[model samples]
Target chain A: MKKVRIGAGSGYAGDRIEPAIELLEKGNIDYLVFEALAERTIARENLDKLKDSSKGFNPLLEERMMRSLPIAKKKGIPIITNMGAANPESAGELICKIGEKLGLNNLKIAVIIGDDVMETINGYNTNLLETDEPLHTIEDKIESANAYLGADIIAKALTLGPDVVITGRVGDPSLFLAPMMHALNWSYDDYDKIGQGSVIGHLMECAGQITGGYFADPGYKDVPNLERLGFPICEVYEDGKAFITKVEASGGTVTTATCKEQMLYEIHDPSEYITPDCVVDFTNVTFKEVAKDKVEVIGGRAKPRTSTYKVSIGYRNGFIGEGQMSYGGPGAVSRAKLAGDIVKKRLSLRNVRTNHLQVDYIGIASLHQEASDWLENEPYEVRLRVAGITPQYDDAVKIGQEVETLLTNGPYGGAGDFKSVREIIAVLSILLPRDMVKTDIVIKELN
Target chain B: MKLREIAHCRAGDKGNTSNISVIPYDENHYEYLKQNLTIETVKAAFKDIVQGDIVRYDLPNIHAFNFVLYDALGGGVTTTLSMDIHGKSLSSIMCNINLPDIRD
Candidate 1:
């Protein structure tokens, strides 16, 4: 069994190349995985921004990954990423174009589709998988539908001699794990090996989670070179075990505690971790800190999988607007809460019904308000957050403007920051039956 | 059935559709809750408390239930926004159910 070096890149807002380029230049990694596409970034932009016809911020992220290809090719490293937000094909085509411009004729780009058919799937009448309401009734038209593709499609693309694979709606971990399966030629049913690889992917998906980004170590704050955080690297073996490490002399530490914290992320039950390909039993897994920057992972095993694939459905419901204000003064907490009431009252008087409204003091409890009994004390500063969506775009816009009015004469609460409000798009997730979904992997030669 | 137990419960679909799995605070008693509680009963209990139409289904041999509440938010699908920009809490509309009296 040959040792394969896998590198995972942390996803951040905007394009970042220095970290990945540094890894390729030094580590001589076999595979590079980049995870992008956060819900917050997507929700702020317009739908057209996601489409191939547009070259918005997301395309810039793809371009950043594409820029690394020339350097990667020089080092003979293959790259895979989920930078494809709404259009993987366009992203792939754009990558191929960049490869051509770079004069790398051998670049093979594979585009994975079938994940974007959310609208088509919603129209069909099928057994109500969960909701008795026919899928069509739940959605008039799907705004966006993406399939959380597993490693198999990526493995298939890698086997086809593609230097790069671009995918939309792939699980963040799958982006990194697929390369391991392809490099090792690991069987899909190899439960232990698959589970181990999945664990590695999980750790690396959120790049900083395994590093010191969320480290509880008291000294983490003093870790050197915070500006240039080094991404994580996985040294995978053929026996379904891997040691997660980072660049030598990297600024962050990879202790057992850090690795354990990463494992707990987005995890519901450690015992029954589900993925498209396998059910990873995280409870059986063990971790050992072998060195300063290394953590050995073992004991991962797979369980039977469900017959269906989880689908993320985004629909065109209506327009929404949100505005926030900062309050500072005596009784700021009370003042902010009162301001929220005033805004709601004014909107209702105008026959403008908002879907939701919330007010919170920054230092006080915002999410778990009822649970936070300590918020009774007045705080120095409070943030008033208000949000609403309506079928009529005009109504949503009006509500957004009304929130800005709070800064003028509406409330004497305190000084606050107000800016132009934007439109809110609707997003929903629905599961598609297994038989109805099939993944196709094709390798296209760079022109 | 204290609301706190399931109040922060998070549910999401796995495959290609929107099948939701509500994460109860206690996984050990998930089976007991599922067996005794049907979609109708759960919906009826909280119907007046929350918005949206209740839709539920039973899986084969798996003692769990999945439910989707249609138009639960005031504005239906359009009303709900992403968690990033907007700080408004969307899950507050759901009335918490207490199950202390039915404990084994």
Candidate 2:
């Protein structure tokens, strides 16, 4: 049986890197995929690059690569990641530099660029994908724009047979799909196989999410050893059938329940889960518990994808101000509510202008507004959280500053009053015709 | 039993839209969820937050349903004043609806 075992390393930009070390050292995986970038993260990284040229890629790119690369190289496992984020070239260079330092001078690194359309952003703005609004309305405010490039470009980079591939703004699933496509020699037109590979990628893209990290509940869906949770690995057969399991002796279990939840995660339509690579269909997908901690995934099919690509545009929206204070023991909800009122009144008294503001007593209806009765009951401990957005940076600062004043004033047991204000980069989406952008692939050797 | 008792869920957001999938923990409960967890029920349950239309899609094989609520994320993850701007907690909240213990 020709099978490839690909392990998912990191889920988000700042996700735990230790688990990846565990995967590289013990997972016995052929390739490792790390999904690190979110829509706004790139814009933030781009801002960092503007401030300092060497700082644009994922801030932890070097540290993560520094930890995992040697082990990956030793195991002969290739690494694929979107940690390149806003700067794949720089990320690739940094990885090469790390390789050189590790005495792995024969390493080959591939950097996939051309996802960034900051200069060609004018290609968008004709219309928004989901709305009738013109994207050009905020044209000048646009700071960064990157298209979600497909898997084929990543497959192109794989053709060079690099030791590691770093990419910017590629689709999350595409990061994993590209490897399967390359290793299996599957064509883009292999809709069913591509969808199967993509489903595997989607499950692996979130890393621990499928491995019981976010799937725990006390007495209901209890996951063991969650504190030291392990990452996931998908063993994909040549026909695109796969099974998800974690590293041996590591924590977390992969059953039909975990696989089902992850399969549905972030998918809008099961019959036609759209991606640049394929229109995945998970409606008929079955998860059979073949063995303990292993489930065979079957019935993933696909149709052709659309000709257009989704471009995530990041722009300076406004600023955010937030502050939190805590109160404990009996009557904590009322005490926290009082503290929240005091800050709201204080902010108004200070005439802090803001587009919107909210004060919530954590642990009581903070998530489900108006629908929760927990707001009426008394909680053992209540943390007062006050946050707001304002067009002015100073005003954003004021919203949180007012809350921090509770340390001396307002509530008696007020503690942990923290304040912060920062610029917010808002993201929006627009569609671009497939022919408008050319996704370029470049391979670089360790220097 | 409440819907939460019958199902477990995970919520995901993109732009101003949110997709919350409700999967019945027991396959036997799928029929009840399909019957009661209607678009109207979801709309009314989340009427306070869901500012846009509600569209539901079925995943019969998986014994689940994906409810997409548009204009619900308060302006998406990048820009939202809500403490949970990602609406990550909305899934547990989605399970708060009523589910009949016995259905034919």
Candidate 3:
């Protein structure tokens, strides 16, 4: 059976880098992927790029490339990643520099561009998926509008024989699927094969997620060797059959439970799980523990893709101002409550204009809020957190300022005061005609 | 018995929406959970936080129920003031639901 052993390098931007290096060193993988971009990451990166010409890619791009490039080059394995964020061209150039620094020459790095549709998306006058409002509603606030590119273009880049493929705002699964499409000679119209490959991509995209990174619940759902949770490796066959596993020496377990959790993560309707390439029917997908650390994944189907590509639109929503103060010893909850009251009243007295505000006791009600009435007794310690959304940065800063005042303003034993104000680059979605978003690859090599 | 006794769940988010998957620890408990863990039940448990509609999708082959709650994350991770922005902790809250004990 023609099979591809693909290693998941990093799940998110700040994910641990050691696991990827570990995979390259010992996993004997044919391909490696680092799925690093999140919804708002590229939007923020766009702002960064506007500030500096050379900025905008993933901050960890240099470090990740410096670490993974040499190993990937030496092992004759191609790498794919969306660490490019808002700048694939720059990212590809940086990778070439890193390769040259490591004395590796002729590293063909393919950079897939054209995901940015901000200039042209306005013409569509599309209704935002979340609010059903026209794009013009938040026109001034729009920072980025990148279409989710599919595996087709990425597979084309692979044919150009790039040592590494870097892309911006591509569908997460497409990074994994492209390798399969290129190696297995799968056609774009082969929805079944593409669907199956997408399933593998989705499972591997989150790296350690399927290998027990997020599955631990102590006694209830105990996972072994969690401290050093191993990233996942998918052994995919030509026929679309695949098995999820990890290296023998690595920590974490790959079982049906872990796979099941990751398979449904962020998925609303299993049957209509939409990706740029196809609509996967995850309802039929099944996981069976065929071995200790191997779980076979089977039965993924798909329908033809829609004519539209999903575009993640990022806009400047507002500024979030937050402040936190800790109170300890007996009656801590009461003290925290009093501290919250003071902040709330102080904000009101100051006439701080806020779109929304929340006062929470960290140890008690921050997570579940009113939903968590199950706390039968008062906690010995609690951290009071005051946060609010405001249009102006100055207004947002007041929230934190008020919380910091609780230390000297009353509430005895209050310590560990913290405050921060951050601009919210909120993301919404819209569907764009697939053809309207052009995609082309730029190849970079050492001099 | 509590739902946590027989089932484990994982929560994930997309925008302001959140999806919680409930999978039974024991294969036998799947049927019991499917019957009792209704949309109404899940909605009741999450009434305070979730502000939109809830839909339950049953995957018989996998023996899991995927409950997707709309407008659940206080306007999603980016804008929401929720501490657990991704609604990752909602899975634990989901597991805390009360369930009728099933005798062997």
Please report the candidate that would top lDDT against the real structure: 3
Q: Which residue pairs show collisions in model 2? A: none
i-RMS for every candidate: 9.1, 1.3, 0.7
TM-score per model (chain B): 0.48, 0.92, 0.97
Which stretch of 10 consecutive residues in model 2 chain A shows the poorest summed lDDT?
A369-378
Top model number, TM-score? 3
Superposed by TM-score, candidate 1 places the C-alpha of residue A447 at a distance from the truth, in angstroms, of 5.1
Sort the candidates on DockQ, descending order: 3, 2, 1
Query: For every model shown, what is its TM-score relative to the native structure?
Result: 0.76, 0.95, 0.99
Q: Every model's DockQ, to 2 decimals?
A: 0.09, 0.74, 0.91
List clash counts for every candidate, in order.
23, 0, 0
Give the winner by DockQ: 1 or 3: 3
Tens-digit lDDT string for candidate 3 (A192-307)? 89888898899988999999898888888788887778898998999999999998879998989899899999999899989999998887789999999999999888999999
The list of candidate 3 runs beyond 4 A from truth reads none
C-alpha RMSD over true interface residues, model 2: 1.3
Ranking by lDDT: 3, 2, 1
- State fnat for each of the candidate structures: 0.11, 0.75, 0.91
| Ten contiguous residues with the weakest lDDT in model 3 chain A | A372-381
lDDT of 2 by residue, A161-264 (tens): 78898988988999989888888888889888888888888888999999998898787799999888999989999987888898877888788889888988
